[model samples]
Target: MRTAYSVETVRAAERELMDRLPDGALMRRAAAGLAATAVRMLGWVYGARVLLLVGGGDNGGDALLAGALLARRGAAVTAVLLSPDRAHPGGLAALRAAGGSAGPAAAVSGRALVADLVLDGITGIGGSGGLRPEAAELLARLEARRPGAAEPAVLAVDLPSGVDADTGEVPGAAVRATATATFGAYKPGLLVDPGRQRAGTVRLVDIGLGPHLPPQPDLLALQHSDVARLLPLPSPESDKYRRGVVGVAAGSARYPGAAVLAVGGALRGGAGAVRYAGHAAEGVVAAHPETLVSGGAPREAGRVQSWVVGPGLGTGAEAERAVAQVLEADVPVLVDADGLRFLDPGQVRARRAPTLLTPHAGEAAALLDVAREAVESERLVSVRELARRYGATVLLKGSTTLVASGGRPVRVNPTGTGWLATAGSGDVLSGLAGSLLAAGLDALDAASVGAYLHGLAARLAPEPCTAVEVAAALPSAWQQVRATAGTD
Candidate 1:
């Protein structure tokens, strides 16, 4: 798993490491790593022209020292100080001694400077709100001077300039880096977006802060091997009953295709049998003859290990009854789509069994009675809030799918694409996750694994594929995950 720490945690770890090391030892370690990264990016450091946006804090000091190292390698380096008087004295002296040029921010005045790479050390982890007026204008000027593929590559020092390291929030204008070389460990902002979007390709530079850090992370992202281990596997002695059955209370007279899609996703989700109960049972049976189809209400759906409710169940009283029946079941339940609309928060909060609520930004906004923009902008908070409010695992689905289970670190899904936003995708996810729940995976594992598979399938799609196609590609995605895991 790739883990992320909050700014406070990172600072504490850094302080601990610094206390044990000699004077200037930590900065030297950071500068060496930063310089090595720059050298690799520059290819031929001997003739490369490097530009540094030096700041007042350690972030700028690190970049300045890196510039000095590059100058020793015959690179033409220039340090443009945002705060001339407040710059790091040791770093400044090193740059000057190495024959690198240094000047005030005004030196960039009305001039188009060309460089092989631009290092953004304007601000770091402690920065809050947005970019300062002077820095913002300077970056704007630099951006205007260089545009498109022809522009110099930008590498941010530590956290990107103008991003909240703790929240991953880009309050205002921020530097969009070509890549970022983060020191010690990953910051929360470097993983979550809109800060994530600003940080291009993030590379962690070890400065030996691991031993001083906390045991747990603020956020976690699962890798393929982790997912492989979490997925419920059937053994030679596994029977249909032992494997478990998933009940799907989805679709209606208006949209029977939802039932078909959900059933499709569930069948491929490692479930023993898929028991579908709804008005669209006929359509579902026609699509998949193997499904145990029944008419109306979850109580009549026979025995099921888990239930996937909502998808296209509509907003009628019958729909409300269906949600009530499924919630009343003494098994794990996944609430999604139309099911999310009619759920009673009191009932959900009072449930003894696990409940997973999968909601997009719009649905989440309606539930919280906040604007859609608010939920979308603060996804990490929104997901965690939803989980806390309802006392159930909440999967806030969007650009970055997040699964938060109360006090646990929110799991940020890394394998997703814009194409996964197609219609019926969430329904497929609900069914798949529900199947995993029936197969005995916990709410978090089911949601995270289902989301990972869903995203991977979309990425593997050759072209613009529909939700059905995405579901159809699941077996291949499952095999692919297992295959990769085996190698490890």
Candidate 2:
């Protein structure tokens, strides 16, 4: 698993490590790593043109010192200091000694701005809101250069400038780095989007802060091995009923396709059996004859370990009654799509069994009573808030999917492509997660693993594939994840 720490926690750990080391040792370690990455990016460093966008503080120092190292290796390096007076004295001296030149941004030559590589040392984790006007203008100028071969590879010092390190929010113009060399630990901003999209390829450089950091993390991303260990594989004695049953209450007369897709997802979600109830039973049975179908509401659908409610069920009186009845069941339940519209927060909060809510940005905004734009921008905050408000786990689906529960570190889904934005994807995810819940995984694990597999399934399918193809790819995705852990 990959863990990300908050700025406050990272700072405390850095302070402790710095105290134990010699003066400037921490900076030296960071500089060495940054320089190494630059070396790999440049291939042959000799005769390479390197431009450093130096500012004040340790961020600029890392760039300057790294440039100094490159200069000594026969690269032509120039530092364009944004804060001339506040530049790191030691770094500037080192660069000059190593044959690197430094000057104010105004004095910078056009050739320098269009160098082969541009190191953006403008701001690191401490910055918030956006970039200053002067810096933004300078970046704009760099961006305006001719496309294709003339474009420079921009490498950010710690993180991309003008992005919130804690929240992943890009309030204004931010640097779009070709790659980012982040030190010590991964920040929440680097894993979540808007900031995530801005930070191109991120490389974490360990400065030995692990021992000093806290055990708890602000965010976590499950790797293949982690998911493999959590998978509920059956034993030799296991039978269909023993594995667990997942009940799905979905679809309407107007939209029966939703039920078919949901059932398809549940059938592939490693569940022993799937019991489907409500209006679309005939459609579901036609699509997947193996499914146990009932024509009545969820209450009459026989016993199930967990229930998935509200995909394609219209927001009418019948849908409301179905949702209410499912919520009344004394079993883990997943609420999604149309079910979310008819949700009673009080009823959800009062449920004895675990409840997981999957909502896209628009749905989350409606639930939170905020603008859709607000939820998209502040996904981390919005997901956490929604979970706390309803006292249920939430999976906020977007470019970067997030799963959050109270007092737990938010889990970010890392395996997804832009192609996942297609219709019915969320419905498939709802059924998959509900199946995991029935298999005895807790709400958090179910939501996280379900999303992990769902995204991976999309990636495994061919390009431009529909949501049905994504569902068809689940078994392959599951096998791949298990293979990573050397399991069958």
Candidate 3:
């Protein structure tokens, strides 16, 4: 798992570490790591062009010292001091003593710092909001002056300039780095969207702050091994009844394929049996012969460990009846697709069993009575709010899928791909998650693990395939996750 720490938590940890170490020791360690990465990115340090966009405080110190190191290695390093007077004294002195050029942004020749790399140390974790006018102007000139279509690679020190290290929000202009080398631990902004876009590739460089940091994290991203631990595996004595049965109430005459895809995903989700009760029984049976189909609502579907409601079942009277029946089942229930439209918040809030609501941004916005853009931009806030309001776990699906339940840190899914975006794909996810619910996982676990597998399967499947192909790929993804657990 990848854990992210808040800025306040990071600052407290850094202070503790600094108290035990000698003065200037921490900066040197950070500088060395940054310089080593820059060296690798440049390939050969000799005769390379290394430009440092230096600014105030420790971030500037790290960049300036790194520039000095590159200069000593025969690289022609130039430092464009954004804050000429406020630049780190020791760092600038070292750069000058090492035969590197240090001056205001105007003095730096941008006739194309042509080629190697540009280091952004304009701001660190402490800075907030947008970039200063002077800094922004200098960066614009630098970008415009780059030699025709072959601009130098930009590496940000810590996080990219102008990104909120804690909230992952970018209020204004921000630096877009080719890669960001963050020290100590990962920050929340580096893992989530707008900020995620600007961060590009993120590399964590340890500065020995692990021991001083808190055990819990602000955010968590699961790896293959983590997913493997959560997956259900059968024993020698296991039977169809023992593994657990998933009840799906979905599809209608108008859109029978929804039932087919839902059943397909559930079968691949390791459910012992999939009992599908809906108006599209024939279509489901034709697609997945193994499914046990019934032409009735969930109330008459006999016994089931968990229920998956919605997914192509239109917002009609019959669909409402099925949704109400599933809600009264006294077992975990997953709400998705058209079911989310007529969902009763009071009923969900009153349920003693776990309930998971899977909503795309548009659906979530309708639930909250807000704009879709609001939910998309502030996904973490929206998901948590929905979970609180409905008294259920909520999975807000988008570029960064977030799973949140009351009083728990949101689990940011790291495995999603653009290819997963297609018609009927969401229906498949609903069934897969419902199966996990029946398999005895909690609402949060089921949703997160289901999303992980759903995304991994999409990436593994052949491009431009239908939702059926993505669902079929689940077994292999599950096996691959389990098979690679030992390595992790």
Candidate 4:
């Protein structure tokens, strides 16, 4: 898994390392990595024009020391000190000794676009709120210089200026970086939205602080290796009954395709048997012959290890009845789509079995009785809130899919392309997740693994693939997961 630590965790780790190392060792280590990245970004350091937007803290120190290194290598490096009084004296001395010059912040106006690179050292983990007035003015001037001109490659030290280091929320104004060279570890802000969009390609510089950190991560992205371990594998003695059965209660006469898509996803998912219990059983059987068709409610449906409710289940009496039946089932339940719309947190809480809710922004908004925009704005908070309210795991889908169980750290799915946002996608996700739940994975693991596979399948598909294609791609996705198990 790709783990992200909070700014507080990173600061603590840095502090521990600082206590052990020599006085200026950490800054030098960070600067050396920053200089190397700048060199790679510019292709050649010699004769290149570089501009550094120096701030007041160690963030500026990193940029100054890196500028000094580039200056010594024949690059024309200039530091525009935003706070000259608090600038790192050691770094400034190093730069002057290496032939780099310091200039006023106003020097950025005309020459910024001509420079090969712009190092944004305006803020770091210690910073709060938006950019200071002077820094904001300089950025505005730089932004106005070019619409689509080939300007300098903007690189940020620690984080892009103006982004919240802790929450990843770009409150007012933030710098748009082409690349960010962060020290120690990945921050939560870099993994979450708004802030994630501003932070382009993120590079982590090993300043030897990894060992001082805690085991629990604030945010995590499942990689192929994580998926491989979490994925259910069958043994030689496994049978349809032994492996696990998934029961799906989805679709209506109005939307038969949802049943087909859900069953399609279930067939490809790692389930021993898939039972379809709804009005659309014929459609499910027609699409997937392997699925055992049952024309009744989920409660009366034959034995199933897990149940998936929702997905094209239209609102009204029938949908509510289906939802009610699934809630009372003995096995784990995954609720999605229209089911999420008709859900009651009290009813979900009363259930004896584990329940998982998968809702895109709209469904999540409906569940919370809040605006869809609110859920999107604070995705982590929204997911956790929903999980706490329903006493079940909640997966909020978007650019960064967040899965949160009550009191557990949220798991963010960083896999998948924008193509996964197409119609009927949630149905496929629900089916796959339900199958994993049937295979005995906990609510969080089922949701996270399913999302990871769903994304990997979309990525593997020819771009612009439909939901059916995503469902069809699950087998290959699982195969890829198993193939990379030991290697990762």
Candidate 5:
């Protein structure tokens, strides 16, 4: 799993490493990594003009040492000191000793000042708010010099200046970086939004701080290896019944494709058998000949290890009845799409079996009785709150899909692409998750593994693929998972 540490955790880890290492050793390692990345970004270091925006902290120390390395490699490096007197003394001396020059922050203007790259070291984890007025003015002036002339590639040190390192919030103006060279471990801000958007491509530079980290990370994303271990694999002695069956109640005459997509996903998700009970039975049978069509109510649909309800299910009495029946079942239930609209947290909390709720930002907002923007603003807190309110697993779908169960650490699915946002996507997701649930995975693991596979499948599919294409790509995603399991 790809784990993210909070700012406080990173600081503690750094302290442990610093106690054993010589003075300035960690900074040198971080700076060397940064310099190597800069060389690769600029193609050739010789004669390349580089600009460093220096601040008053260790962040500036990183940039100054990197400038020293670049100068030794024949690059024309200059540091624009925003706080000259308070700058890292050792770093400034190193740069000067290596033939790099320093200039007033206000001097960054005109064609003569254009640079091949700009390193933002204005702030670090200690930064609380936006850029200072002087820093902002200097950036504006530098930006104005280029006037959309393919502005100098920006590389943020640790994080983009002005972004909250812990919350990913851009309280005010923040620099946009083409890449970010971070020290220690990945920060929560680097994976979350505002900061995520600012951080284009992230590169982690190890400063030997991993030994001090806690076993449970603050945030985590399931990788292929984690999914492989968690996914249910049928044994040679297992029968069809032992493998598990998933029952789905989804779609209406108005939205028949939803049923087909959901069943399609279940079939590829390792379910031994799939039972369909809904108004769109014909559509399910026609689209997937293997699906067992049930003409009775969901509660009467023989037996199933897990149930997937909602997904294009229309509102009103009929949809409500189906939801109630799923809740009454002894098996785990995955509620999604339209089913979310009729759900009551009180009823969900009373259920004995595990429940997983998959909702987009809008549906999540409705469940919480808040604006859509409110849930989007703080997704980590929002998903956790939903899980606590219903006593179930809640998966909030978006750019960084978050999955949280009652009092558990939130798992973010990092494999998804924007292309997965097509029609009937959530229906496929719910079916896949329900199949995992039937295979004996817990609610949280089922939701996270299902999301990880669904996203990887989307990315593995050919570009411009439809929902059907995503379902077809599941086997490849599963194969990739198994391939990585041994290594992990």
Candidate 6:
């Protein structure tokens, strides 16, 4: 698992490490790593033209020192200081000592400076509310790509400039790095969206802060091995009932295909049996003949280990009654799509069994009584808030899917492609997670693993594939994860 610490936590860790190390040792280590990455990106550092955007903070110090290292290696490096007076004295001296050039931000305006790589050290983890106007203009002039000319690979020091390290929020104009060399540890901003999209390829540079950091992180991103360990495997004595059955209450007369897709997802989600009860039973049975189908509310369905409610279920009184009845079930329940519309915080809070709510940005906005834009901009905050409000695990689906539960690090799904934005994707995810719940995984693991597999399935399926094809690719994805853990 890849863990991310908040800025406060990271700062504490950095402070602890700095106390033990000699003066200037940590900065030197960071500069070496940054210089190494720059060397790799430039292919050959000897003749490379490197540009450094320097600010006043330690972030700029790291860039200046790194520029000095590159200069000693025969590269032509220039440090353009945004804060000329406040530049790191030690770093500026080192750059000049190594025969590198240094000048003010104004030096970049009219010059058609051609560089192989640009290092953005204008701001670091503490920066917020976007770049300063002068710095932003300098960055714009340097980064503007000419017609048919190759763009310089921009490398950000530590956290990208103008991003909220704790929240991953890009308040205003921020540097879009082609790659980021994050020192010490991964920040939440590098993994969550808006900030995540701006961050290209991310490489972690170990400055030995692991032992000083907290045992618990603010965020967790599961890897293949972690997912493999969580996946339930059948024993020799296991039977269909022992493996668990998932009950799906979804679809409506107006949209029966939702039920079919949900059932398909459930069938492939490692559950031994799938019992579906809703208005679209006939259509579900037609699509998946093995499904145990019945025309009734979820309560009338046979006992199930878990229940998935609300995909295409409408917002009318009938749908409301169905959602309410499913919530009344003793088993773990996953509420999604139309089901989320009828959610009563009081009822959800009062539930004895675990409840998982999967809502896209729009649905989450409606639930939170905020604009969809608000939820999208603050997904980490939104997911955590939703979980706290309803006392249920909330999965906020988007470019970066997040699963948040109380007192646990929010899980950011690392596996996914933009192609997952297709219709019925969430419905399939709801069923898959519900099945995992039935198979004895907790709400958090279920949602995270379900999303991981769902996204991987989409990638495995042909491009622009329908939701049905994504469902069909689940087994392959499951096998691949298992294989990664040597379980296959």
Tell me the tens digit of each residue's lDDT in model 6 across 3-77: 999999999999999999999999999999999989888899888889999999999999999999999999999
All-Cα superposition RMSD per candidate: 1.4, 1.3, 1.7, 1.8, 2.1, 1.3
lDDT of 4 by residue, 215-332 (tens): 8888888888888888888999999888899999999999988988987887777889999988898888878888998898887779999999998888989899998888888789
- For candidate 2, write residues 309-407 as lDDT tens digits: 999999999899999999999999999999999877888899999999999999999999999999999999999999999999999999999999999
TM-score for candidate 3, residues paired by index: 0.96
Between candidates 3 and 6, which one is better according to TM-score?
A: 6
lDDT for each residue of candidate 1 in 334-423, tens digit (9 for 90 to 100): 999999988778889899999999999999999998999888778788888899989999998988888999889899898878888798
The sequence of per-residue lDDT tens digits that candidate 3 reaches over residues 1-488 is 98899899999999999999999899988898899889877788999988899988789999999999989999898888888989999999999988898888767665535547999999998889979898888777767853365678899999999998986778878899998989999998888876888998888889999999888888888889889999988899999988899999999999899999999889987779999999999988888999988997788777899999999989989898888888988999999989998887898999999999999999999999999988877777788899999999998898888898888777888886888889999999999999999888899999999999999999889997679989999988898899997786
Most lDDT-accurate candidate: 2
- Model 2 alpha-carbon miss at residue 225, Å: 0.2
The deviation in Å at residue 119 for candidate 3 is: 1.1
RMSD of 3: 1.7
Candidate 5 weakest ten by summed lDDT: 104-113
Q: Decide which is better by TM-score, 1 or 3.
A: 1
Q: What is the lDDT of residue 220 in candidate 6?
A: 89
lDDT of 6 at 29: 94
Stretches > 4 Å off in candidate 6: 109-112, 486-488
Q: How many residue pairs clash in each candidate?
A: 0, 0, 0, 0, 0, 0
TM-score: model 5 vs. ground truth: 0.94
Clashing pairs in 5: none
Off by over 4 Å in 3: 145-147
lDDT of 5 by residue, 64-152 (tens): 99999999999998899999988999999999999998866766446545899999998888898889999888777777864467678
What value does the lDDT take at residue 20 in candidate 5? 92
